[model samples]
Target: MQTAGDETVITVYIGLGSNLAEPAMQVRRACEALGQLPESRLLACSSLYSSPPMGPPDQPDYINAVAALETTLSPHDLLAELQAIEQAQGRVRERRWGARTLDLDLLLYGDRQIDDQQLTVPHVGLPERAFVLYPLQEIAPTLVIPGQGPLADLVTRCPENGLQRYE
Candidate 1:
């Protein structure tokens, strides 16, 4: 974490996923878009992973990765930007856990915990989701998840049935 004048810059972790419209390309493009976010810089990104669909199994598999970022934007504002990116990418919210062109989830925002209707930090499913845990563990294994514990520990308890490191 750093400060720009009075504004605080927080190191945030983001999860990116796509299952449609050239999944890998969509993810790479989203990574580029993340770097372009206001007052944010992409620090490091984990290698992509291929994971089975979480919500429904019938859909296509997803391309997933986690990113570390430094940002001055408040959590809500950053969430808004992410939603905008999804909207721009032709994302349709017609079904829950449906296939998507692009999906950006704010996995961790510093060490702060937020649980509002609009956003949830340490993403509600971070601990149990293999897709998220895999890439996050890859990029920042020693990282702690505030209300939870070390990411390394979290990664251990989670099953790795559907996660494959995308080469």
Candidate 2:
């Protein structure tokens, strides 16, 4: 885990998705867990959504949402926290985009961009993921996606496709 010297709170956006083992419950529980991190506080979470699987078509659709958080932990530490929560939720890395009990991604870390072996901020595939874009729009309509564009524009370009509010 890494920490910055300042220890000031930074706002971050997280994307959560799951397609197996009671996904809705998994997501909600994950949100609850976010508020318990060592130096983090959950600020907001988008409504749950149902979207077609981003990978194999045979699997179940995914339940997804985005969360906003204010944290004093560095980006790496925050990533570690998210992975721990997923592990606690029984996440297994069997196959890429395969069904899972939980999928927690560090979508954006205080307007910063990162690309490395372990993770990528603003998600490398953010531009094309309706599941992410929709929920993000709900919580942060005018937020920008760094190199991509404003969240509002991306949401409009994102097709409704197989997504629907999970209500």
Q: What is the TM-score of each candidate against the true structure?
A: 0.97, 0.94
Indicate which candidate wins on lDDT.
Answer: 1
lDDT of 1 by residue, 43-118 (tens): 9889999998988888999999999999999999999999999898888887989999999999999999999999
Error of 2 at 40 (Å): 0.8
lDDT of 2 by residue, 73-157 (tens): 8889899999999999999999988999999999888778899998898898787888898888888888988777798888888
Best by TM-score: 1
Q: Tell me which residue pairs clash in candidate 1.
A: none
In the order shown, what is each candidate's alpha-carbon RMSD? Answer: 0.8, 2.8
Candidate 2: C-alpha RMSD after superposition: 2.8
